[model samples]
Target: MLYWALVFFVVALIAGVMGFGGIASASAGVAQILFFLFLILFVVAVVMRLARGGAR
Candidate 1:
């Protein structure tokens, strides 16, 4: 998931450099959504582990 976010981010950067505004904006949006999803999942997992007393 994080890998995909990074991939889109890089693609967006390249597209922006090439002046493809539409494609860059779309890719950036995807990257942003994926990053936030990944972060939310990570936080949920950590909270679950802590609740189970599995902290390390």
Candidate 2:
């Protein structure tokens, strides 16, 4: 999931550099959504682990 976000971010950068406004914007949006989703999932997993008394 994070890898995909990074891929889209890189794609956005390249598209922006090439003056592809539409493609850049779309890719950036996708990257942002993916990044946030990944963050939320990570937090949820951590919380779940702690609730389970992690490492004990």
Among all candidates shown, the one with the greatest lDDT? 1
Q: What is the C-alpha lDDT of each candidate?
A: 0.99, 0.98
Give lDDT tens digits, candidate 2, residues 1-56.
99999999999999999999999999999999999999999999999999999957
Clashing pairs in 1: none
> Which RMSD values do the candidates have, in order?
0.5, 0.9
TM-score of each: 0.98, 0.96
lDDT accuracy of residue 44 in candidate 2? 96
lDDT of 1 at 9: 100
The parts of candidate 1 lying over 4 Å away from their true place are none
Residue-level lDDT tens digits of model 1 in 1-56: 99999999999999999999999999999999999999999999999999999987
